[model samples]
Target: MLGGIIEFLLLKQSLPIGLSLLISATVVSLIAVLIHRLFIAKTKNATELSLIIMTIGISITIRGIVGILVDKNAHPVKPFLSFSSVSLFNLVFSSQYVIVIFSTLVLAFLLYFYLKKTLSGKIMQAVSMNSLAARLFGIDVGLVQMSSFAISGFIGALAGAVIAPISFVQYDMGIMFGLKGFAACVVGGFGNNNGALIGGLIIGVAESLSAGYISSSYKDLIAFLIMILVLFVKPSGLFASKDVERI
Candidate 1:
């Protein structure tokens, strides 16, 4: 939603690219926080289920609003980074892809360090493990959840900003990306950051191989097939350990 609006502002209204992105990020963040406070925090039963339903509704609403505002057309975005392609051995790659790789690696390292070493990150981990226990220990679980949501929103906005230049910005552009991300989580281990990273890499490779060998149309099918096969073979996920709780 923000991506579409940002593209519109940048291309249609001739707004400065940086300013457009900043404005979209700010507006989206505020709206997300408001939604979380008003509806998500007020849910009384099955919070996760409620959140999923609310998310679907919000996604549909955003798509509709973006379509109405920007029309159901794709908008091209100017490349944020451009460089000559480089060849190493027999392989050739664009500088944009290299930047993406480096940025991903840096972000992953920072996230790992933060989660493992920082006080707030540890607190967030504790909340994830057992919110009731964290609450009993004087940690505000609601605050932790809110902070997590904010951080997630920030990361998502950054990703959109980075990828918008490479891909056409459209009202429904996120649907496939979001589904693939969900598949990655399932393939790895849900709630496991390391697993998510590994899962995403595996999916990327799989999709590429499928498109090369099978067909472009089968790329998505292959991804979901991998996900389904993993679930059937080991529902705990490839990286997840089975846990047995004592009664």
Candidate 2:
């Protein structure tokens, strides 16, 4: 919405996408902070009722607004090139698959370096590793948490944008994307970015295979089954942090 509004008003692309991404990140993180401050942090109880109620309200509000905006319409995007397959070792790969795999690897390395080499990244890890110690070192824990959430939001938005170019994105599309992304996070092990990436890829590949071999309608069920199997065999995650000690 911001990007579209900017391009219409400014008649330029120079600042539209970047500025939209920034604002989206800010807004997303601000909402997250509001929920934390209003419900989670303020509550004496640990049952999460406040948080749940707030989120339920948010969900209905979003859906109601989106439902009003959408019509019974469908459109599709046409790729610029002809369909062709590339042979990679034993498996045959399509252009889209190749792009997805390459981008995933690049994103993985970029995130790894971002977390390891950057000062903010160090602070983020420190805050998650030991928040009390991090605070004692003069780091603003609240600010760090907000920044971390902002980064997560930015990534999520970018991923949505990428998918939108290929797949039709409606206002309500976030539901399925968020679910899959959350599943990936769980598969990756919460608080571990590397794990998230691995988990996402694993889920993607599993879904692809299952859809190819089994009924397409059962892909979701198969993905959940895979998740259950992984948890049973590797409780933390198949690609959980190496430093994590098993109980």
Candidate 3:
């Protein structure tokens, strides 16, 4: 929601798409860091449930503020490409879909590289695996958490901006998107990025198939139905590692 609004505003000012995306993502990343520094980090002895409630409250606050600042009406975002679409394999696709796919793959690869090859990323992984143990090893758990939030915000903002051309910009649009993301995480295994990616692909394919073969109205329902089935069949998810603990 915020990302789409920011990108829309930037584009309205005639900023280049790439520049607007970079600035919007940077601003959102900083805001996420600030959110942790000012809110999450300040909580004393915060339980998981309390933290979750706090995040929900924060989300509502942000949404309400955005609604007031930006009109609630949906706004169309221009496509990144000058051309409308492209053809491949005897099929036509919106140019924005190509950009979205490319961006996802690039981001996923970069994220994998960072987590697997970088020192700070390793520290982050350590903290995520065992904060107390990481702290004992002289890692700054709080810093790692803040970095995690920043990365999440950056990626989320880019996602919103890239998809805006297709989905349009709306103040409250994040709700459904966030729900679908959670469903993806559930369908995949929590803490497993590979699983999450595959899970998202499955959901996306399912939604597309439903929209084609069934009523378009059943798209969302089909995604959740698949999620429910997955949960019932394997609560840990299809690719969940035996060692991976669920939260």
- CA RMSD for every model? 2.9, 5.3, 1.5
What root-mean-square deviation over C-alphas does model 2 reach? 5.3
User: Model 1 over residues 17-120: C-alpha lDDT tens digits?
Assistant: 66776666666666667767876888787576778998899889878988897778877766555454667787997755665576667877887888889999
- The best candidate by TM-score is 3
As for candidate 2, its clashing pairs are 188-195
Point out the worst 10-residue segment of candidate 3 by lDDT: 238-247
Residue 112 shift from truth in candidate 2, angstroms: 1.5
- Judged by lDDT against the true structure, how good is candidate 3? 0.90
TM per candidate: 0.87, 0.69, 0.96
Error of 3 at 30 (Å): 0.8
| Per-residue lDDT of model 3, residues 119-187, tens digit only | 998888888878999999998899899999999999999999999999999989999889888888878
Per-residue lDDT tens digits for candidate 2, residues 1-247, read 2111212222233345445445544555565566556654565754647757866776666556645654323333232125646777888966555655565678678888989999988999999888889999999987887666556655555455434435554556667667777778768876677888878888988898989998789888766777777667776776666344557
Over 4 Å off in model 3, which ranges?
242-247
